[model samples]
Target: MRIPVPHWPSVAGRARADAGPLLLAAVVVAVVTLLAGAVPPLVSATADAAVRDAVRGSGADLQVHARMEADDGPGGSRARHPRLAEDVDDFRTRATDELGPGLRAVLRPPVATVISPTLKITDGSVLRTFQLAYLARDGGPAVSWIAGGPPEPTASETAQVPYGAPPWPVQVGLSEADAAALQLRPGARIPLADDQGNVKKAQVSGIFRPQDSADPAWRLVPALLSPVAGADGTGGTRFAGLLSRESLPDARLAFGQDELRRTVRFTPEPARLTWDAVPSVIAKVVALKAASGSSGARDGSLKWETGLDGVLRNVSAQVGAAFAQASVLLLTLLAVAVLVLLLAADLLVRRRAGALAAARQRGMSLPVIGGELLLESAVMALLATAAGLGLALAVAPGVSWQWTAPVVVTAVAAGPAFGTLTAARATRDRRVPANRSARRWLRNTARLRRAAVEAGVLLAATGAAVALYQRGVGGGVLPASAPALCAIAGALLLARALPVGTRLVLRRLLRSRRPLAVFGAARAAAASARVLPLLVLVTAAALASYALTLGAALGHATALGHATALGHATALGHATALGHATALGHATALGHATVDSPLASGLLRLTWVAAVTLPVLGLLGLALGTAAGAPERWQTLTRLRTLGLRPREARWVAAGELLPPVALAAVGGPLLGVLLARLTFGSLALPLLTGADFTPAPPWWALGLVAAVLLAAVAVVVPVESALRRRRRLSEVLRAGDT
Candidate 1:
């Protein structure tokens, strides 16, 4: 028996029929996508987590320390590289000879080193090394601290710094509460003599607060080993350190320097880098050494090459390859799904002979049927496109995702329109005797909706969601989100509503000229039954994600501006040059945090922050064009739509720029920042690529022209063809009815 979908023609019922179920479904899908999946990754990344745990014994994996003055520059200012301190002779043998294969052992060559600055001590008169300490006898003014076994000046210049003596060498934490005998803040300056028993001044750099981290708490008071200042006023005490992967100190040290490379091991396995990749890094460092070569370099210079634990390039490439394969497989899946939907639509349309005949007998216009059918095709295509996007969003954060939504939406939507046209080509015959086949299809509508039709819809949509989620969860592409479950349930209900949906819409919107629409509607309803909900849910997912992403970007930028400096750029510099490029992204030179409690925030200014205005403007222009293609296309469509005069369309399209203006002027730059931050995960910006500062102003104009021209050509050329074809159809059909 043919299924006749019930129509609710009353304005209220029709309204409900048209939009009711979809509204409910969107909420459900959102909820499901969230609760069923999200929150785990969020928890993992928060509250100070480590990707790898400690190797569980009281031994160090890698130790870090300053290279001696002869290798790096004197007094803790020079660069240093990490070297494996573990009796390399033994490990070297294990790697080359014994690592033959009893077990698959992987030792990735370490790439960079942590430079630990050193402190030297010298006194005022005898200006020896920085050694001043205290010795307590029968209380001859109570000897306080000892540096190299005697007392010394607590500060270099008395009135220069408002703050007292700078921090001491390796502090043995002392608290006044712990020792009520040492009533210690200001009046407790320890006196020193230059081997002449004369009083020399000494004040506390720290009176250990039990809570203060400065207190190492082993009891002996820390002595100021050197002068309070480095004489150059650089905060040689706190703001001194560099962590680099490729660059290193000039020479290797004796066995005592073992605690310098913090041995961090990757369990799933750290990828091994080849010796070849290090040459470029080695070259860059060599050039810097040459360009900024210190005359003091006559003492020594760095000479290095890639070793087992020195470069990560080879491992980085292998990981990228894995990601690339996953991307290819995903794209292939999308293309196959779109093709399947089109094929199904084609077969379904071919089978509906009576619907076409009835449409013709009723004198229902061709374009109306065509338009409605085409629109349904659009709906199908849109839904799938949306689903793909939904999948991407649902997968982002834990996984890297890249795509412009409108592009994906258009691709998916076009598939259906093309499919509809293909189906329409077969529906040319529109005359047939009305019989029980058409009448019966119009009769069993209720059961068709509740039973066979909805069953297939729910089954397919739910199955896809489950399968995708299972794969994602297991593979760790997507953590879990509450919205995921909502998305799935919403998709199911949307399908349940599809068979009767178009009929309800036509009954409400089509006047007398819609019989062909009605008949075509019946045919479209059943043919697309299994797929509708999935499509809608997917569409909602994509669009919702876009909205959420924009919000997230804005929020992130606001956060950076608030938490850090106003001129701060959020992108981390994986390499020195990349760090400089990231700085160029801003409009002006800004302060580097230089010191923060968190190591990530304490950055040394490598170069003066400067503008790359022309590049930035051009990039902005190109970005606008790329990001707003839909708006551009709409403007062009308005310029040449059938119903409107050119001026009228122009007015409508121009009005859209208002919101854009408002956003540019008053909208937070956070969205852009968030988007930029997201780029980090995808390996879109390499460590080296961020260094180009050659300003190209005129180049930006050329980019704008190219974008406008290309966008115009792609949109206009096809539209012109469509307009001419639509005009020709009008004359032929009286022609065909239209939207």
Candidate 2:
């Protein structure tokens, strides 16, 4: 005979009746998947942007220009020497070859020339001049000019002034001030001399003036040549002239070796490279220098200066470490979601246990019953997965295909699998004996199984802790996973201690003369079935407390580091002390922490957001779990009311039972969390938090806040139970038969 499969119509009808709990389970799954899909990319983009801003602001990617120094002899005497054109070219070529495609263009502006000139003006009065090179490469002389811009060079005129070699007969450019002082114009020939008194003739090819006297390029202009007699017969300094790069060779030849060596300053215009490519460029340069040393080749002292390598490494490490934390948090949320769903499934199964047992008695096979349950679970999972994906897309659009596919698969599979397993476990064919004592049931082997499971969890958590400690929080799952595992282990240990502690408290309450206390204690002592739910509730609250405390502590540390960094910046004159001081003072007054730099601010924000979000998620999970247990609470309250227990006494009984676990979690979770946070803080590569002198401390206020929130949540259970009691009729509740 073919076994008749359960029809879909019956399953659909049952699911419709149970829509409230099913919808809640679906929402929890949706939320967990949404976070899993969204956090990684958001974190990566934020880190990259912060690092880029920090590197760019510090000018770390700009190439430095240094004078070549030579060790003269066996005694190791060193002297500064002019960098030859060939030497610069060779270094550029090595840098390009070593760095490969990542290397962008290299600029080598011609050496600077110092010239002192005595110009014979049209009026026959003498004018003194000081001149230095003005090149066309990074927005030239005209770019800096405010009035009377530099003469535009023709194609042929530009071709004449080749790079690295200056043109003869010296083409020079003059600032408008210098030209006005001498009554000179473009193409006007002027006589110039070095400090050693050697003279040469040069034509002014351009005339320009600086927008600001203190413009960096203007500072390159040599100081006024020796003073000249003014029209009033008193000596006055002449304005400096801006010469073309083509004037360098002619000036060098005219001035001769000694005076040119003493006075002229040659600085290559800096090359700008991308922020990401800086570390690679530095590495290549170092390798080339090492190779050159081994080969006994002539080496130029190329002094590379930057904190960029450290900054980049730290950025990458911090991002990795933070993502690890996010992963752990995501996993915790998922675990909680799964547990809540399973509990909902178990509750649903228990409510229909009589129907399930009756169906079994009528020759319904386990496969048929399991199939119906699985089908219902599958429907819920499919709907939940769809809702989750939609929510994820809405919140974090452009999620990578890798993250999206896995999240979808996990959500689809997880709900149905867990729900089916829970239903199967709750719907066993054997009947529970009506005469089983509460204490005997509480001390049963199934209770031993729970203890074993807790032990296994504690062992696993210990292993994870060892692995995390070995890994040292550099940039991976350990940073996040360590805390999560510790929280779990701590929660389990706390759960194990609750029954014994509650019995002792109940015994003490039984001796009281007060009827409320005696009744509440008796009720709490007999409520053996509430152990698991109470354990879950306490664990969730504890996890939330721990997360908040850790986050607040990290935020405070980040703020302190930033404040210290800002103070250092002000002391070093990098920023105005008055402005920063005022801002910092205001922030302090407003009870907001401030960071000095962009990188620190980004890190601080990440910690603060995680801290706030994780606890809220834990609370949400707790609320769903509570909602699932409402029916049982209502039935229990109905039975109590029938035994002459008042609604006020019922509320007191609920509070008495819940307060122990909530109080335990509140005290234990933070202490364990604080310890975990202290251990994990060293792993994050935050500049401010990692140093010999850096000591991280817990945010005590945050711990207190978490305790208050948890206690309030526990307190809410009483009112909720009372509200649930008020809504149900005594007749209906009495007929409900111990649900």
Candidate 3:
């Protein structure tokens, strides 16, 4: 069945008249689709980067280090220590063979020594003694140098010193602090004595600086030895230095072979790899361990260590958990969007009901009418989906196909299906009894059915909440359905109670002598049509209030964590400066500093932004829902105006009609939201608030803001709509007769 071409123009005109509500329905689809398409990939990328940063900063990736173990004879007598270089070489080869291409970079430091040496100053006064370590590898110091650049090569490949320095007879580098302490520059000769009493005259070749002393990377760099003038009563400052491979024989000779061998060991430090590469590296490590043996011991019975596997697993779990939480939010937003769209579509259908009934009277079948409405809805859905996709692309350029495809399907299907269903349900014909009473519309069976449906939804939501609580206890991602189901059940229950409560309050007001009070009560008693809009408004308010409360609480906890970490660092710094034998104390302090870094802060901000923005969208939908009912309201006020009600009095009556529901929602919605949030917090056992003394504060200011905006909307829309109707004159409205 086709819509006749001659009648197509008439149908199109009717559609145009319903354009306002239709557009609102389209906007809801667009917003939901955009959020669904954009959030996942962005969240994944952020999580991956954060994991990578943490892994790199902590030096937790795959590492191979050699240690000497004494071999025992058959009777348990100690035989000999394992050969260092040979064992390390065998382990490196086996690890490389096992990891293959997955291995990033391997670092091997040649044999060296950390020795306390005294610098003989030009003024014949020694600057005191400090510890200096020398590296015999070219790239070893390059990894940790923060100043004066890395050492440059000499004419021969055997030696490297500071950039632009002439070849020293015996090359040595000093840390920046050491260079300043001895007032020594490159090319200056210094006589150094090791603990073994050997003296070597060496030229200061370069000055290099290590990273922050607390950084794990600082341990990787050789420091320059230096002595402080006024020490903190223990001794002078100790710094490390790096030297080329050519300088190794001198170090061995000065410090002795046994001492050097005991002090220095070869270790492989994995270079920084991309976050995506982490899983493959972890897999390789696992395979290497499995292939090795039951003990999984490396050469020389050395222990192989890598925290990359655990870090990656934890990060992946965290990403999954965060996405799960976000999914609950998305589901909630989608539910609200669908509700708003259906309400708007129903309103549009009712506005066009007269035209539809007239068409039926002229012999148009229901199927043809339904088909036309469905086609219109499909077009709108497609257009809105296109707009939403474009917006999603603009907002998150790196969004993957995995995120976009499902959302697109949901966007395209949901809008048209809801629109068509609403139109069909609203346009259905039912014969009216000649003497039908209002009491018949309020039948006990109808109330019971509605109550039963709400009860079923509430029971399902309760079951989901219980499941979510169990999942939280077991420690994994919480299902999105938990909170979403709760919100939906709460909204349904609120819808059931609100109209009855409002009627009771207005019935009491009807006895008052105030003209506006009586008029508003009478209007509200007859305004059953406004129930869905009130429901939508209250739900939006509740969700927004909950989000704001959660965001503020989490934000406070995050700030506290950051401050606590900083305080620990400060105390550690003070202890180190006091010359206490407390390197272990410094490590403990530094460990606390990693709890709340910039990456975690960024994630919190993203969460808060999303939380706040979602409610704002809901409020927009609520405003549109309110505006859709304006024409009927304007006609009612215009009729009252014709009965000698002043224009100002009519405006007052309109305000009175709108304010009661808005006020009730403003008070009740946030309270319900807070209750829901508290239940969610208990069930989820969210880590954000764990170990912190924080209480969820109700967002009273946010509630007030929502209330103010809604009241302002009523004031503006009602007055503007009424004035427009009055300007058209009473005769015209009567002639048009609600068409």
Candidate 4:
């Protein structure tokens, strides 16, 4: 003791003392980081599901078709032989080369096809015109013989069949259904002629059926499977008469090379598509189109056609809308996260205010104190953020820097900023209370600053609204931040109204004879300066309500799509060709809020988490905000108790203090939610997610449920907080140097 040992704080002691605030900060940073990190992957999954759905629905239109008229040699020299196989392979090679690797990966091998000009077969008085179709066996669907076997090639060596008098007919096959519709069976022979007077005697060699009609092999030439109604005013059904691969040479001899149309088709494999690949695939398709056009113009023969570009463009638009919709939920989460983080920071600072002030009195510089706090916050926040991002990557597998970085930075910085401000304010508490005039001047200055902030928020909200409205009306895309901006503006407005409403209650209570009512009202009026809790509660309430509304809308839209799909299936008599019903059934089985396939499950999960988190965050924020001043409140209650205030009167005081914010949020939240929904739904394109449109109105029951839940939470949390304050004994309050 005589050696004068300096009393330095131990690291373990500081860690123990700072544990509560550090844990709180860690949790906030972790949760916000996790949610932000999950967004990119979840949004990507939902958009990918939409893309797959669009591609699935496009059917044959989703494939690329290159069609060209088979040219006959000049002057009918007939010396040069056409190599159909070599020509097809060359076409396939060119197409794949033009499409690029990204697009080529998702496409099936090209299907080469040849079609003869329209030829009529008269069965009694009714005529059925059909095209003699030949598909390469290697790339087409597997077919089963329903009656006869495959057709045989003609035994002619010359092009034009030598104009023989008794030549064998070209052997052709037809689908069983088409054959029945045409009134032709195996061995039936019919003389068919085109408009150019070119004639061919076709003998029915077999009736075959596709093993899987839904196979992509049947997509390009649907007439090969079913009879299509002719639009040539002949009132005849059109059919694609199937010809064996060996019949190509005879077909050219019978129909002439110029009379045939040759095509190469590439069907898209929907399973291989992803949201990230859409733009690249579209670009490749565009390049392919340009290449084909230039080549076609040069040769005056080859041309490529496809609707894949249009389909991909639609999917890209849908992805944009989906991300915009997701932004509303994520931004709401972030806004509330920031608010709760600040409230938590304020609580941490309040707990350290005495020590910080003592340190200031010991001649510590403000910069030094701020730097220390920043380092402490940075260390804890960085650890939590790393863990959270790691967990997010493990769960969803993608990092969204724009969303995650801001949340992490804000969560880390909030604590140090609040601590520095609190330290500065606490050090000045040594001065005597300001006189009335000085207090008035200070209050006026604070009011002016608040007014400026609120005016700026209002201006921002207005600009966002105008931009969103213009975008929605003109392009059907709402600006992503519009809903969040409006929510903040609405919350600020409600915060202003809170004080006036409490003052009105105070006046009414003063008029009453009951002393407890007056006391509770006066307490509520004094607490009006605490606007953070009110803003958090209102904004959170609005977000919860808005999320519920969107959920219900999505559910309704999904159900409507399911119903529509079922209706189509019923109308079509369960035709496999109409696959939308099956797709919607799959979506319905997953849940009522998502689209087809398991990829869309992330959307439902994310929305549900947001819906649950927003309300809980509000409740936590309100509790933390109230708890920040718990010591002062308890001290005041202790003094009142000494003056004969009853326990019932104390409870009333606590309830009154909480009632304005609770009631304001309960009433204003649903209204703000409805306003935000109205503003967002115009460009949200909810139908893109579920394939059905719904009314924009918030369901009455859902609104009531959200309001009731918020009230219930506040009712429970406020009383619990009040009871916690009461747990501190009178001796403890006095030991804390309460006067």
Candidate 5:
């Protein structure tokens, strides 16, 4: 004979039977996990792009300049002269060696120059000081000859001055523009005298112009390409006369050992500079500065200076601020997710109450019941978490464990924790006591607990606000939870206010002759006790409104031609009038930080992900929150209908229950969102992230539209839920109520 088979249901079968609540919880967990994986990497990438843009815009400021006196006392107390091309090559090797591999890739080849002190030019009737500059042609900016050719060494034997000048006069070249302005021509001999009455002669060899004026190589000696007016507070202009490497020997004598300054300038390679390399580059720069500084006194030996470290530090600070702000958004989403999970758990427990109660009657232990429920919750959490993480990795690749861990832990724990709590409460005794004093005592205890929780939330919000205010955005990096704390506190406060407003409406309905309105108001007043749903709705509404407002602002910021909208109209017109080359240079410089640039585009992309995702999540969460109460609401409505209430009257009661709080959320959400945005924007450096001059502010119409849409959505959900609830038979309703 064959053994009879047992009929036991699978966990999947049970989950499918109660899919409504489980499905919602699963979605919440998965989305939160996905965000945990996706958001940080996107924020980091955007921040890196911003860092690159800042470093690129810094231009010549990122250059490291090391100055060493060409003539110093030798081993024995003599003025020492630096070797012409040899010193240049030696410095480059030293720079690369000091920086090592950390900064070597970003470091451009060093350009060497020998500069002379201010000397009176005695060639023209106009008085002027000309600085005799000899830039080694190797690795220098490209140039085109306008007249004559590059400067050459003098051939005269007597031309060699006391320092190390050639035997003849030093020959120099000037820019074509400088030549025309100074009324000097090639082959003209000009006499120059120093403050110490040391006279030297210089012959103009050829006039030249830079192929690319914006080339940073020209920035090494700025005055070489352009005439500097009133350089010494005198009426005369200042000019730099360029000489070839061959003229360095003659130039050394022309300026004297005391006045001769040799500089090795290293400009950064823009393409090689990136966010990850910033810290290493900064450390190397500091090390180089220290090594170069310790050589001797400030002006005695080689001294190095650069603004690169400062620039990188600034970018780091900005990234920190942006990350801190993003943390607030993440935390807010997490808080909303937790609240939604709690609501789902509440609904799930209520839905299973009949079966759970029957099991208890059959002597099933509370621990056994809770364990089974927990196992189911754990299974759901695990599956959702895995799917979410897989999706996040697929989208963004990297997982920031610090950010993801909290979300994972919360997701795994929230469902089971809430389920056990609800089950424990459900299995408690339900017999009513005859004494009013005991009931009064219970009410007092509940009031005390609520008061304590509210006080704790207020205290936490205050502490976070104080800390954030003290730190400010530029002060340094901040804890991510500060804004979230403040937002939760604000939402709680609004939630508390909602009940009072509903009570007032209830009182008015009490006075009114309309029975439907009175019944509806009574239903709304009862719902005040269920603060979790209200809190979730209020917070979600605020976030949704905030997202919309931010999206609109971003849209305006990234709108086409926005980069050129500011004063560029005239600039563009002027560029056209000036010439193609002039216009192109101006456009290139002006558009360096525009919205169309990679920096702004990256920022927009990251923010748009948030801007688009939040509103959709908020709406779905609101739907889940609303649906969580549907079973109980339908049970109550069914009983009222059996008690001779018309179907229309039942619908009115449901509307009453939903409309008051939903209307409150709609009105209060935008206001709260605006307040939250205002409070956090300064600390977040929002303008820096957007690359906009002003912070974004949503107009009244936008705020109003958000409120109206939320109200409309709730209004629509009311009838849909009512129609869905009406589908159940009376027998099913009575059985559910009994359970």
Candidate 6:
């Protein structure tokens, strides 16, 4: 019977009761889902600020805080690499500090610390020793300390002389950062005195506290804060974090972005005068050093690493680019996941055609029917988007959201478009002629068959990679699930080479006696069986290329560190006194001792700067913006089946949805957008670069996985719900049997 259709109000009450709650729930879900991506920008900004702040000294460019090595090995030989620039005679000229570009910033970090003991009773033995010290007394604010109370005026004056020459020349006190690092709870004494023999003991009265701004740092007087001599200047022993700023006037003008100012007392005059006005500064410096005799040579190889400012820009860019590349990939994947879920939603609308048909019989027009059907789609899409946004903001504070008019418009527009498509398909499918039902059934069956075939291919490819991994053919590069495309092609050529094993299992599991459960199982099996080939192909091995490439790169970095260590050891008879050792040396360094060293053996290594190293962690976090919605849908379905406990549901959601929703799309995206704006849009320019273009593939791969995991759940959950209500529909479709 062609049933009479009614208007919106006629069936509005019934429709609201059935689909209203679910649709509302969908909106909530979308809101929260989208919200997950909201806060990433803010966090990134904070982190970036902290990192830039922490990169305090210009020397951070080439500085390794400390290094140790064994010297005078068997026959005075040192492990060194020939290819390295350690002992190269030509490098001496090339490494000259005459580069005009390097004339900008000069931030001398803490020279090192000194420790003096007036009294010490270890193992029931008392020892008194003057300590060797570095020039840390009254140093400028390089580091800050957090302390309460105060420090002692006088130390016990018992110090163990670990390595100090008599008459120690100059020594600096420990920095607040350094003091904490050593766990020398306040009251530790620094060895003070030019005389290494009678090195006076200085107590750790207090650490220097530095404010973020230079204004505060300059105004801060460590000695005044913790006066060593006290107000009356009669204290026996006292300590203070001193900053030597005699060079401040000089430093003020000399300190540029990545350069330091050095007071070179001599620059030799050209012996033969040529009107070429630009004096060979390096040649002059070398000549001056030669004339300064042993005094200048003692300083040795002063390579003025000017032009640090330019390097800083490049380095920061390189780092930001690498990480941002990964971020872009994640974002793309996430966007894709949403689209897929939308696709699945369209599919579900088709599946639920009978429900609409039943509604039509109760007097509903096509438009009214759409209002009924679209209630769910509108709800889910909005909810997922909202949830994603919420998750993003909550996790990553300071996320700058660009509520672009277009994006908002598109999202809003997608709502009704999604509804219209589902509504139209469902309404049209309901009225399909009876002659086409056979065709529809055949198509579904064919789709399932195709899915099964794909699963078989994946399984075969995985097996091959597994075999290769066992034989150590690939260097764990394919450890995840690398594909030898050639082998896969070969497997494909073998006509009967499908994964029959999975089909058998599916057949067994779907053989249930119960109706709904059996039907669900059958439907899932057909759905999943076809998906097996794709799943098999998505094995960890498929991700082997990423691990392999990154692993090799990291290995190269490790090798560089080794090479650096080797170079240092070969230069000095022993590994030179490193920054760590400087604290123990008090007095003057002796006269110039030049021993031409040979490159005895090769030690492969490389040196690394540590200042901007931690930024990688943030990038690691922000690379999860894309994921599969199906994973989420499936999980939610499973959770619902498991009694739909709130905690369990949340847990599943977090594990499945939080990565892409919170980190990538919301957090990272916001960070990227905000960072660009915060710093004059410098951050945004990089986005349109080659670095961004690199990580696109892997990002897409993972992003898809993440989006699929989440979006699929939404589609699957609704489909499964509708499926449960399918008993009557199934009966109606069944052929009538006669006795």
Q: In terms of TM-score, which candidate is strongest?
A: 4
Which segments of model 5 are wrong by more than 4 Å? 1-10, 61-83, 95-105, 116-133, 136-167, 171-245, 276-300, 359-375, 394-397, 425-434, 473-480, 497-512, 545-615, 677-698, 735-739
Put down candidate 4 lDDT per residue, 1-739, tens digits, no spaces: 2432222352234446878766876887788788888787767877777777666655433233444434344454331233554565566566556666777798776677777777775444565676788776355578899898887765634443233334336788889878877778898886676666555688888899998898766755677898875322336667777776566656666655465666777777778888888888888777767755443342424467777787678667656756766776787788888878877778777777787777767876677667677767677878988888898888885866677666667667877787678768766745534698887888799999999999998898787778777775224223566677788889999889888988998898788898777876777788777878788888888888888777777666666776775565454433433233443343333332223323224455666788888888887777787777666766777778888987667777777776778878888988898888877776666676565777776777877876787777756865677677677777777676542
Candidate 5 minimal-lDDT segment of 10 residues? 2-11
Query: Tens digit of lDDT per residue, candidate 1, span 637-716?
Result: 43345454454333333333212221221112222222322422123111111111121112223323323432343244
Go through the candidates in order and give each one's C-alpha lDDT: 0.29, 0.52, 0.56, 0.70, 0.67, 0.32
Per-model RMSD to reference: 21.9, 9.1, 8.0, 5.7, 6.5, 20.3
Structural similarity to truth (TM-score) of each candidate: 0.29, 0.71, 0.74, 0.83, 0.78, 0.35
Error of 4 at 197 (Å): 9.6
Would you give me the overall lDDT of model 3?
A: 0.56
RMSD of 3: 8.0
- lDDT per residue as tens, model 3, 605-709: 555665565566656655665566566666777788789999889888777677666665676667777887787765443353222446677667876776676
What is candidate 6's lDDT per residue for 1-739, written digit by digit as tens? 6553445553455445435333433443343234224423532443243223323221223211111112112443322222211222233223323323322122222122212222221212222112212122123334454652223212122221222323212213344544554344455645333222433333454455644334322221222233222211222223334323221111111111112212211111222211121124224333433433232242334432222233234334433433332332222222223332343333333334345555555545666555544554444455555555666666665333442122333333444455445445544645534678777887788868865865775675566445444642222223212232322332233212223533454467557664334333333333332221221122111222222222233334333433443444444323333322321121101100000000000000000111011121112222211122333333434444445444333334333332222222222322222221222212222222121211211233433443343334434444443344333332332324200
RMSD (Cα, Å) of candidate 2?
9.1
Q: What is the lDDT of residue 484 in candidate 1?
A: 28
Give candidate 5's error at residue 213 in angstroms: 10
Off by over 4 Å in 6: 1-39, 50-54, 57-307, 310-318, 325-340, 343-352, 358-397, 400-574, 577-739
Compute the lDDT of residue 673 as modeled in candidate 6.
Answer: 21
lDDT (Cα, tens digit) per residue for candidate 5, span 1-739:
5442212352355577788778878887888888877777877777667666666655434333445544444343333233555665676566555667767688776676678887887765686778887665355577788898888766542332343433236888999877887778999876777777667788889999988898766766667898876554446677888877667666765554545766667777767776778888889888767766653354544567776787677667656656665666676677677767777776676666666666656665556655666668878888888888888888884655565565556555665565556556656886556799988888899989988998998898787776677776444223445555665677788778877988898898888898778878887887776777777767776775565555566556545334544355456645453332343344434433441344445544544555455555556656766776777676778888888988878887888888877777777877887776667656556555454555667766766776776677777887898788777787898884453
Ranking by TM-score: 4, 5, 3, 2, 6, 1
Error of 2 at 170 (Å): 4.4
How many Å off is the CA of 201 in candidate 4?
1.6
Model 1 Cα shift for residue 129 (angstroms)? 5.4
lDDT by residue (tens digit), candidate 2, 1-739? 8875877776877788777767766676566556656665565555445445443344233232233323232333222222333343454444434434543343233222244333333333454434444332234323354344443322232222222233235555666556676667877877655444545556676665544454333433423221223321224344444544434444433332333321212221233433345457456545434443222223343333334444445444544555565555554554445455555655566556666666656666667767777667667666766676667677663353344344345434544454445445555675655766955785687778877888887887777677766775543554456666676777676666777776887788768888677655555555434544554554555555555654555556565665665555445443333432443343332211121233344444545555565555455545554555556655776787898988877788667655666677668766766776666655544343311224456677887777677778867767975785697688887784545
Give the poorly placed runs of model 2, Cα more than 4 Å off. Answer: 1-6, 62-99, 105-131, 134-171, 176-205, 209-245, 251-311, 321-342, 352-397, 400-448, 526-532, 573-599, 624-633, 687-697, 727-731, 736-738
Better of 4 and 5 by TM-score: 4
- State the local distance difference test value for candidate 6: 0.32
